[model samples]
Target: MKYLIILSLIIGLSCSERTLLEDYVFDDNDISVVKHEILSSTVNQGYTLHKLNLTSLKWFNELLTNRPIWWHHVYVSVPDNLDSTRPIFYYIDDGRNNETESPSETAKLLSEFSTKCKCITVIQRQIPNQPIIFTADPKSKLRIEDDIIASTFGLFFFNRTLFPNNTYNNVPLLFPMTKAVKRGFDETVKFLKSKNVNFTEKFVVSGASKRGWTSWLITAVDQRVIATMPIVFDLLNWQKNLHIQFKSLGGGYTYATYDYFLVGLTAKLDTKEIREILKLVDPLFYLEKYSGRKFLLFSATEDQFFLPENTKAWWQDLSIQTNNQIYIKRLANVDHYLNQQSKLQIVSDIKVFMDLMHKETSSTRTLPILKWYFENNILFGATRIKLSNLGEFDSYTVTSYSAKTKDKTKIDFRVNYLLDKSFVDSNISWIEAPLIQSKKSDLAAVNEHVYRKLRILSIFNYVGFYLDVNLKLKDSNETLSISTDLNIIPEYYPIGDCYNEECLGKLV
Candidate 1:
């Protein structure tokens, strides 16, 4: 028994000696910027837009035939009234590099955002440095986001059939991608300091889609990131996500996840290697390790890649770790490709959250507190919501409730009046089925023929219904939108059953 214990301890120490995925993320003890050039600078509306090209890393050794190096053309919009006290609103976005669009056109909107918010904005492009070719059993050209990630994951698996040569061994591409972001930020800071500008090192990290995924992981290892705004990427607790996404879609993966499915990455979902990978790469695994970190999870109800049922499985865990500091925003009637309105909505919403964080940093304010519950409605033969701390929300008057509910319940309030009057109401496509939309909208598009296909596919296969509370700041025009966790109906989907034998009851 003594020999066994000693041997186990030695093995554990050896495993701990292995370089963690986080170690690779900021692997910059040796790397230096190959080149950083300021291509152009423009002053627009109290913001200075500086376009820069920064080549940062030579990652892993080489993957089969592709170069291990990467570069990004960054756009940093500096607010003229820079507040040293506030955390920089750093947005990490992914789009085509500078070669695709003119520098002026690319930097315009973000520069406007900086001018309006009065905060520094940084956008790093070409994050994964794509168009990478890896020659395995079959040569594959990876450019799309998921294709890039899964292929590197394939290398980690040393999945011989996919990566026949396995020349790169098992170095993940994610590390290099994350390292690029950090390096870009470092270079930006150096550039600013060289130009005699100074501000806080703290940041509110944010990004959309795959960048959003990186935003979550960035906060995990980078304490400099004081808060995170992960948009359109609700992929926390990935093991459960894989199981639930499959189970909810009637035991099949969504077409949106084609890259992961194609690479046979989905095939390895149930394996021990994947579990080991999760320890290194999964965001939720690091949540407890870095508690009290602020998070605002922005999601879409009809996101093509992620289902609405997914959030409920992991939300309780998130709220607890963040001490209820985490908030949620679920845009209605939108797909993964967010519409123009949704895009503007996201920025407007984030602006309010940004102000909240700014004030909290100076100890002038704290995050709003609100609570809720469901009670049996005897008259309606259904459930009704009873808010616990309604008074805390600055403008959550009884008027916010629709006219139907106003007559049903004696509450005198005005969502329109308390906030701005011209609230842009969303179009609702309510099919009205089990575990689907629970609220009634004034403009319900109940045309089954016009929406029958969507109902057949989405309503039956997916559900994302939740109530939200909108609060006004004490004296600001900005409205804060925080969502309750998605309502989960046990029967709507098999929340308890581990239908897939490989899942082994990993369902949360």
Candidate 2:
């Protein structure tokens, strides 16, 4: 017996030591090295603009600059295997030069993202909206400045061509460099795809002012993007409306020329034509097309031209059409340029959204149904609501009902949920218990049938309060009813009061 015990003890110690050794082993892939590489060849060495078979792109390019040009772009690389598969983001500001190297500027750029995100920084410099091939042009300059002055400014008079019209929904003061931008974006996606990098896991594209417009164009053309952060789109209109101060010469051309060029690109003969065409060019129009996509629109509350009412209109349309995936973020205290605190908040929000996105990529088939509803007025919610394995994915349905009851004058609200085009009639053992005997519950799992029926009660309060109670005397007993037909919508609410699976559920 003693010998057996001794042998067992010896074996246990040996196993423990071996386990520790394995745990301590360091793999080369474990360490992520941040790198910034400047390519030797000209950025647009062999790029071509096949899409601009239209005279419009060529004419527009000519208006900006008559000379032959070469495109410049930067590539940023970060070692894989970080806590999150975060893409090393690179921002090409409004088709401008990409010559930023200051640490403060880099930090400021990085600070725009969420601090909670596991990110390694990378910045790429690229010239915006120029043809992407190296052609034999004697007048073309090799550096960024020479290209601007000689080719764009001096040769083609792009300053005049790129100007905005200052008319509402008219040609923007800054021309849409869509063709050039599309080229860079497609190239980037192809490069990443070749490396087996999936942006669906996490990726962000954002820009301010003119770049904000550029961001909108990019999002409209590309579907692989996970999120978009467009700040102050349609700045020309906003500037004119608010009478805000403006920059004279942006990047390469005079502000006046940029404005003129924008006007010509968006010009329509009349209001009706403009409205019809704007539907295609406007960001709102494309947003409607993105059924399940996520978007964040950051606008200043005090912004003069970009009225809060206009922002609200976009939000309301998105909420009604998208089932609740679009978000509008209003920064109340600051103006167009965000303050330090607002910047931090932007970063934090982006981080949280990215984290949520990463959580979903684990399995494409099933996504945890995030419920933001009210229960007993205490306001409880859950991020992940598991449903029956069979009827998950794009097969969910939502139905809503609203009415005022007669007995005790109460408001009643209900929603019908469907799965895979059919009603989900599963068990609600845990969730039904409270609602049956009691009046409230906060359980994450419910019968597939119950979850389907309860999907349509989104009222934009953040407390996650799923129900509203009104006491009514029916016959001899008291009954409770819920309704969202309220007198006023709160100025702000968590979950954007956006219809997306965000915010609190209302019990009328």
Candidate 3:
């Protein structure tokens, strides 16, 4: 009966409205123009830049059809002297919720890049009392659960006539924002074409921080995007990275409260389940699937949001899997904001990569690869895997056999540390060792030299785990290491128990 009412409400919408909803939901088509007007234009640094005010409508779902939205399009054209055959570079501006009227500082920075390369910037205007689309805010009336159900059904209906074994519900948390941004870009392209602006189909998508995350999503779903360069954003390996952040900086550092927190999907699911859902929109999934595209990851060593270790680990894994199609550059001493020198270096790197890409015809191009190696050792309570480069490659994969069944199960390894050589060389500790994970089983020592100790810290007041290890390396030197893991059991406390100050205080 409820579904009937929804279907009737959808059917009652105007013809144009129904068409808009049908096009957005059923067809993977980009935005069709309802209205477009150039708000302003200025000639700057040998290029003509136009600011367009566009009103567009897209189908959100059955509950919300022909959803009206607005966008600010900033289009920059190639110089008169320069050939119009240049590639297009599209950037999504992160307005930071402050720039309500004009583009943010990052958008201006992209314009500077536009002086040399043809650039298009898409910025979503903040509308007062606008319905929340991207985030599954807990306080929202529509609720995250409803959004998930609608999206799942919508996607399934669009993709398959008959229901399959499993439905792809891993749609990105930022799907609405990314989709709107993509639509705006598509509209801008059409507007440019209408104005007789000549440009190549080779599109490069780049963004910084949150916008960087969007860039990854845009490139993943949109085949029109030929290359992607994301700054200060690491791949989603949420289980390990989120756990570390939660322990080090409390629950707030993970940004779990944000609407885009895996699109609020994690609130109801466990770690493993959340990972499965994230596979729909995670950059790792797309990067691996589209291994032929050019990917450049720019990160800072001292970035507060994205840990340097996690960034390196993600890059290492991607490097191995993608066969070095991905290029990574980690700047030392630079934070996420990136100072003047770092910014200059970033622009230079972009130019270099784009130039190389323009010259190549094939999708698969050989990029510089990082050399590294791994070793797996069976330990008492956990598997210890060591990854070392030291100017040479030395990595290995570990597989475990069950004692009773003898069935081989590959151990999933997560790095806990990449110890510095200087620390190990000072007669202080032996070779660098990293703690990894293996199949859950009875604790037993596979190596005579390695010893493991585990203890549960306070569970009533504050939940934590302490692990201490003493190991003798190949050189006969022994060292002791201590690590801690902290988490709140979901069943004990509600899923988002630590989100607010009041709830957090109660946990103590």
Compare the candidates by TM-score and give the number of the best one.
1
Q: Candidate 1: where are CA atoms >4 Å away?
A: 1-19, 33-35, 62-65, 97-99, 103-107, 135-142, 160-170, 361-365, 372-393, 397-464, 488-508
Task: Give candidate 2's whole-model lDDT.
Answer: 0.35
lDDT winner, 1 or 3: 1
lDDT of 2 by residue, 1-508 (tens): 9999999999777534421111212111212221222243211212111111111122223333332232434333423333546643434443333333332343344533322355433232332433222233554433332233223322222233334551122222122244344444545555556556444333466666555666665555545555666664543222121111111111111122222223332122123433443443456545544455565566653332243334323444555655555554445334555677766555555554454455555345222222222222223222222222221222222222222111111111111112344533222111111222112232224422221222223342211111122222223232212111111122222221111121112211
Candidate 3 structure quality by residue, lDDT tens digits, 74-131 = 4454444444555677765543222356665556666666655444433344211133
What is the total number of backbone clashes in candidate 2? 40
Clashes of each: 3, 40, 5
Candidate 3, lDDT over the whole model: 0.45
Candidate 1: global Cα-lDDT?
A: 0.62
Tens-digit per-residue lDDT, 166-242, candidate 1? 42333556667667777776888888887887787878888888888888877877768888998888887888887
**Candidate numbers, best TM-score first, in rank order:** 1, 3, 2
Superposition TM-score, candidate 1 onto the true structure: 0.77
